[model samples]
Target: MADVRIIGLDIAKSVFQLHGVDDAGATVLQKRLTRARLLPFFEKLPPCLIGVEACATSHFWARELTKLGHEVKLMPAQYVKPYVKRQKNDMADAEAIAEAVTRPSMRFVGPKSPDEQSAMMLHKVRLMLTRQLIMITNATRAHMAEFGLIAPVGRGGVDRLLAIIDDQTDERIPAQARSCLQMLVAQLRLVKLQILDNDRQVLTLARSTELGRRLMEVPGIGPLVASALVACVPDPSMFRCGRNMAAWLGLVPKQNSSGGKERLGSITKAGNRYLRQMLFAGAMAVIRRAMQGTRRTWLIRLLERRKPKVAAMALANKNARIAWAMMMSGEGYREPMAIAA
Candidate 1:
């Protein structure tokens, strides 16, 4: 235990696999422990670097281990995958984590605090509720269309749908059918109210933080985007630069270069999908306004040569970079001076 300098922990609900190595990179320990005994084992061992693949419970474990005086680092699961020797079981995965954590260039994910995690949970719940509402709304509309009752496009269209449910006098929909759909309508109303309540809470929380205010100052980052980013990312400094943050959100293009020839395709579209979508949607809003306004700068020039959607993505990449800078410097976003292309 005294010689163990690194421990790779592959965590599960009931069982955990651990692989430990000494300072000279020699395997010193490979062990499994039940949930009850895991913490006590760590509590008894000497302080060392503990590496875990980031997952649902990794943050909780990382927080717990940190309090016990052990230095804990988290690496992404994808980055650790290449090091798996042969078989892909718990022990082999733990060993891979052990090896990957020692690499000089390996990137680590910062452990999120309880409050930060809670805030992220709020955004996720809101997203889920919003999605459910859309699904129900669409399904209700489709079903009503079958009865020859159609509503116009847009959100206001739902009102006609609800109206049909309320109108028992309308012969188009049978009473039994109306009763069945009214239940769904009730559910739809309930979800909308829940979403509204969540939005209010998130807005209040966003106002409580200086970081959130600064984040909102960036073009296209509304209260929702600002709040979501603030909650999801505890430390912007984890990224070396703005571009790195954007890349982490997968806003950058995918590359395929061979024989010194560079080939770039669509954006990677990896990492935080919510953040990527929010940033891109925000960019679309910005581009829409830019088109109407008199600002004929970089974005306008880019739009002249590229498609609108392409311009939106480029703007999203730039805004992500800007947001990263703002978070790091504790400053509001300032439009950069455009240089000759």
Candidate 2:
């Protein structure tokens, strides 16, 4: 047990599978420990390298394990999948994690701190409330439209419809519809307030640091993007280049090459979906403004040939690269110079 140099841990809510290999790459320990016994077992073991798959609770365990004088590496689940030998089981997964973490070229996910997780939870809650608002708003609008009461198609329109519902003598909508919509309207108001609160919190966090301010200087990055980036990424140095960071967010194109011929397709759509969604939203804001002018941006040039949606994606990719570069360089965004006439 003392000579075991590397252990792969398959973490779970209750039982944890541990596969420990000796210095010569020989299996020395294959054990399953209950949740309560897990930490004490490691506490008695000498300092060594521990490998685990990066999943739910993996970061918490990794953070805890690190405090035990052990070096821990969290491998992405996809990267470890190839190592699973025969039948799939907790032991096989644990062994696979052990093998994958030993590979020289394997990429590992860094464990996120408690604060990072908390901020992500905030973003998640905000998104959930926004979705609920959309559902109720759409249902109310559709239901009211059935009774010959129709309005415009935005939140503004929803507010107008709510006003109509509140009016007792509006004969267009039946009383039953008014009753049903009243509940939805109340829920909508509550959700709107909650969303506003989340936005204010994000904005406050963004302005709390000079780093966030610098990030916001980048085009297409607002308070939400700036704050989310700060909370999620603690070290930009993990990526070798700006494009690497962009690619990690699934902004870069996916590729398939054969016989030295390169074929590129849609983006892999991997990595953090929330960050990607935020970047795409920011890009759309820029595109909305660009539509009003004939001013040729690099984006405008692309828009001339590619579709507006494609152009928007290209701009989002560029913004991701730019944002990463700014984070790495600690420099504020500099406006691009006009192309030589």
- On lDDT, the candidate that comes out on top is 1
Candidate 2 residues 1-341, lDDT tens each?
A: 89789999999999999999988999999999999999999999999999999898998999999999999999889999999998999999999988888999998888889988877778889889989988988898898888877888777798888889889998887787678889988998999999999888888878988988998987789988888888777778888887888888898789999999999999888888998899899988998899888888778888879888787788888888887788888888888872243
Q: Estimate each model's TM-score.
A: 0.96, 0.94
Local distance difference test scores for all models: 0.91, 0.88
**Candidate 1's residue-wise lDDT over 49-100, tens digit each?**
9999998799999999999999999999999999999889999999999999
After aligning candidate 2 to the native by TM-score, how far in Å is the CA of 203 from where it should be? Answer: 0.5
- The Cα RMSD in angstroms, rounded to one decimal, for candidate 2 relative to the true structure is 2.0
Which regions of candidate 2 fall more than 4 Å away from where they truly are? 171-177, 338-341
Report the alpha-carbon TM-score of model 2 versus the true structure.
0.94
Clashes of 2: 0
Give me candidate 1's TM-score against the actual structure: 0.96
Per-candidate Cα RMSD to the true structure, in Å, reads 2.0, 2.0
